[model samples]
Target: MPPHDHHHPILATQGLSHRFKPSGRGLHDITLSIPRGQFVVLAGPNGSGKSTLLRHFNGLLTPRAGTVWLDGVPVAADPARARRMVGLVFQDAESQIVGETVRDDIAFGPENLCWSCDAVDAAVRAAMDQLGLTHLADESPHLLSGGERRRLAIAGVLAMGPEVVMLDEPFANLDYPGIREVLRQVVAMHGQGRTILLAAHDLEKVVGHAQRLIIMDKGRIAADGPVVDVLPLVEQYDVRLPCQARLGMSVTSWLN
Candidate 1:
């Protein structure tokens, strides 16, 4: 990891706002900051601009009203650099998979970054091992199970060695076991000290693992605070609270 100023946030948005011309589906005046090495979850109901706000983190969408800063530099000013530092794993794993085999897919990002063959190979191996995909190295990505495909998408991003990782709806279509597998990997990644931001509608799967939770509603921020503080208000924003939380029980580990 490159040395970063501890005084400044790793990522931030200042009065950021955007709207799709046709549908008017976008964020509005979203001002937030994420410190280095923090694990945060951006939670909201469907179409609440969670995805749109995340797109601005790495310059995927330019702000129409305010500014997005990455390491104190405007993301729009150096998009290439910003993207290299912030990696995104889309909700649909299939759309992002390009290589025929798992190893090839993970190597794609490093190759695009102009890394040497030896470096790319090493990165590919490390990412597979990190995500427990080493045994599936030669297997076709399309043939993998839902959990495996999600892990593959994450592996691809991990190979790029990005400073910040943002995952959108990582547990969307998975079964219980699949969700557990992905959750374990996400927890492990945070353990490794990489700043992480996960976007999801439910707090059931990842709330306990995240330190902070930011709730989005109707294209604006409704709440931003520690997970415990935000979980109680999830229902007010149209997001489902974890069953345990609803039952008045303590939120336990999803993996357990």
Candidate 2:
């Protein structure tokens, strides 16, 4: 069974806001709760602050005004603990992999956590098997396909044993099969009860895969609700909806 409400608060935000330079370009008055084990998607147009909002969950971007909580720990004051439990995977796969070899890349996180050699090896192996990357264990990460590279990046975070995984546009450079493969890994992780916060544009890829949706417009949350409630807004917002959702809306009338 999937994890339910009893798991406690994995990530939460209160009156959160962000600004860029002299001009503010992110969300404001943002109060949200991401219960443990929820698969949440951040969606909006090109200029939306979806990515900026996600950064607060793990303290990648500091809280602009209010507060951010992760695993019940305040993120604004001391971000280290939350950072360990809430891992972030950037949109670009190449930018994250620091090491040349896949083994080195996978071991990087544990090494940062100061794990012993034996423990690091075990963590890497477990992460590889979990993400179905045991075969690419010794190869160079730069040589892997886009999807494989994504898995590798995620594997590095898993080595840290984080409770929440934040992915920013994970489907950016993937082919159809690669998209399917990466989505499968994400679904599997969510199934295993790890909280997932995804910022994505390829709505089709994340439509059926996500459980919750947070829609942003002009740096503010336009709508936030269960996937069933918010997904149909694609057309209402004059934005593109997933193919399946658009069809459902057209046929079901009530969805509109």
Top lDDT model? 1
lDDT of 1 by residue, 13-46 (tens): 9999999989998988999999999999999989
Candidate 2 has an lDDT of 0.81
**Tens-digit lDDT track of model 2 for 1-256:** 1133464587888898788976757778788888888899888877788888877877888976888887666887777777778889989989999978888898999899898999999999998998888999889987899889999999998888888889999889888777777778788888888989998765667767677888888888888898888887765544578766666652221112
Off by over 4 Å in 1: none
Model 2: CA > 4 A from native:
1-7, 249-256
Positional deviation of residue 97's Cα in model 1 after best superposition, in angstroms: 0.5
- Clash count per candidate: 0, 1
What's the lDDT for residue 157 in model 1? 93
Give the number of the best model, judged by TM-score: 1
